[model samples]
Target: MYETFDDTLLSRLNEPVPRYTSYPTAPVWESTTPEVYERHLSQIAKRSNPLSLYVHIPFCKTMCLFCGCSVILNRRPENEETYVNYLCKEIELVSAAIGGRAPICQLHFGGGTPTKLTQDQLERIFFKIVSAFPLDAHAEIAMEIDPRTVVEDEGAKLKLLKKLGFTRVSFGVQDTNAWVQEAIKRRQSLEVTQKTFRLAQSLEFQGINLDLIYGLPFQTVATFRETVHAILEMRPDRIALFSYAKIPWLKPHQKAIKEETLPSTHEKFGMYLAARKLLLGAGYVAIGMDHFALPGDELVEAFKAKTLRRNFQGYTVLPADDLIGLGITSIGSVGDGYFQNVKELSTYYQLLDEGKLATFRGKILSPDDLLRQWVIQRLMCDFAVDKAQFQLKFGTSFDGYFHQERERLKPLIDLGLVSVDPVSVRATALGILFIRNISACFDRYFHKKEGPRQFSKAI
Candidate 1:
């Protein structure tokens, strides 16, 4: 069902590309102030669309060697308590800016490990947001769990979360192999992983997800196959098989990993293919580039219905018209603009103390940006672009407007990775594996002059 690849082809096609989580991408965002963000929120206040909220809990107990996200390592509970207080203040500032009591359809807690907070801290943040924004009756509440953090009182903690309206949770179990886990400095055993999964299942959470990484140090097809088989036994509602993005220049912590121990591109592809085959055989449907969901899952249904969306959090089924981000280093998208909070905790607290939002940088999408974002998001999510629909929406000829992009796609089409016709431009099953590169053709900001240091490889 897919094309075979030789080493030469694989090497040539393995160029770095943006994950396209955002259209213009974070690299192009310009410095801006809270004033600019407030202007955007003013515009949002006039619209009736429900908002999606993202809270970045940046505190973690320890550093995972392979992690590239923004996080702070603190052993003190007081630091977390202080951060939670500031988080609530920021929420109040944003709600006041939006004229108060904006409706919310989805709320996601992410970061270094949201569960790292004490139960009191967690409840405070949750109630503060719900009080500021009236949560819809059908809204989704979710968080990221670092299984080890909850191993002490797993059942009680999970039950507490469920009681507080947490319907979905994702556990970070990067790999189950002992050697690989040791190499990554995350040493949870298969038994612990299984116990955590069973605990969430027994808690009757509506959705449970596990995260896995391929191409890490010392991974082989046989080894990853064993991990995948072990994961299959749990049968989570969703699985995220991410490629190990080794950009040491961007994240210096990654340099701790030995280069020679990491799998080569060809070997990495082998591991991915083996794992994907097993997932498909076990009745999972691939959603977007790195996510897979069971057939009846909302993600699979969204993919089938062409309503799937991609955000900074990766693939998602709930597409909110506006997303409001709170806490340090959080990013938000309102209308045609995107904004981010200050990355430093001190600065975040200083701004909140001044009764201001901590927006540090942002980008207001130009008309060209909006159009290109639409095309790029469609290709990333649906794996195809309907030429007729583009014309209808943008009032232009897709062929004429994207002449250069279509030319850029010619080589991929010739290799049977892409197919184009008068009606639509689509990626074949083989092309889906390289969807990031395919979608990159439409990105106006991605340039050879800028270099590819900012992004990871498509594979």
Candidate 2:
């Protein structure tokens, strides 16, 4: 792919675009209340759709300069306990709203660091959730962890996670280079990362994922290759090779990272190509835009079968019809709407204290919104859209409906990144690298002239 890369294409495609984790991304969700959220929950109850749960554990001991997530830097154990209690309260409220006993097909705990919680804290939260919603027979339970958090305990925490029915664990190892790690303010040594990986391996976790970031400060092509090679040696069941999104204005802590220290656009492209080549050579299958998994992994199987799905939680093999997000700043997609909890801890507590569900913002998908969502999701996950299927499902001619979008895609088509025909619209192998750019074509809201850029570049 790089053999064809040039300054012209970079200049043309390297524009800010939404990741499309969801259509009408979070930035545009309207002000919403718990009452409206409850109405959405009632819709789910009426449909009796199985649901997935995403619990946000937003506490961290320290802030990493490269982080973009909503997190609280609190060391008080009491704070965590309080959050857990409120989280459980929110869960119970949701359960009652949905008429209780909704089956869960997938459950994931993401951070700040889910493992940052003490074992007791984790257990209490975990039991509260499972007790409210029974887990489906083949449900997938997973959590994200900072390796440094578990390395000191000699896998004690890992064992407890397994005991609590967590089938998967994702270890966050942004980079292996000491200099790069230092620049990012995340100093997990290669040795510590490996030890923690081996610990999870020994526990016989059903699926182990390793996350890496490219285009970070102090990263070079050679250094990033070394990082990729080191992670490949661990042979994680799944790998998420993510591009670093630099939005210092949105995440103030990112200011700690000097822009000059970051890799240039061209160098970042080179780093991705190098890492991707290595992963492919290792026989890992690319699942979606940024995820790779070994042949037997469920994600790979899903990708191959074209049953893969995406959401705020990224790609998943066991996605339920609805996703319920718990905890502050967490976002949920239920029925035809998306909703999120308040971002502040004080506000979160206040809402739950008032016996409310804590929903602060949300979007109700309109008919047009649903159509665009389908188109964007297919382009992102399947890298193509079957025009016939679209017509059959949406009761509209894909080309006729998206005539303007097709006109918008002409540039990508001419660049050999996309192709459209009577039957389908597809991305070439080269276009997968710019999937976000391709998906953005169908996004009616992605206007460069619309205030400040809310997303990162697509290169």
lDDT of each: 0.90, 0.89
> Ten-residue segment with the worst summed lDDT in candidate 2?
445-454
Alpha carbon lDDT at 336, candidate 1: 92
Q: Candidate 1 overall Cα lDDT vs. reference?
A: 0.90
Per-residue alpha-carbon lDDT of model 2 for 1-459, expressed as tens digits?
567788777867889888889988777778988999998888778665578999999999999899988888989999999999999899899888987645898999998998999999999999998888888877899999999999998989999999988899999999999999889999899999999999999989899999999999989999999999999999999999999988887899999999899888889999999999999999999878999999988888888777788999899877587999999999999989999999999999999999999999999999999999988888888999999999999999998899999889998999899999999999999998999999988988774344346787886
**Model 2 lDDT, full chain set:** 0.89
Clash count for candidate 1 is: 0
**Tens digits of lDDT, candidate 1, 1-459:** 543698888988899888898888888889999999998898888677778999999988888889988889999998999999999999888888887545788899999899999888899999999888889888889999999888778567778899998989999998899999999999999888888888989889999999999999999999999999999999999999999987777779889999899999999999889999999999999999999899899999999999998988888888587999998999999889999999999999999999889999988999888999999899999999999999999999999999999889999998889999999999998999999989988987785434345888877
Please identify model 2 stretches exceeding 4 Å from their true place: 448-452
At residue 261, candidate 2 shows an lDDT of 98
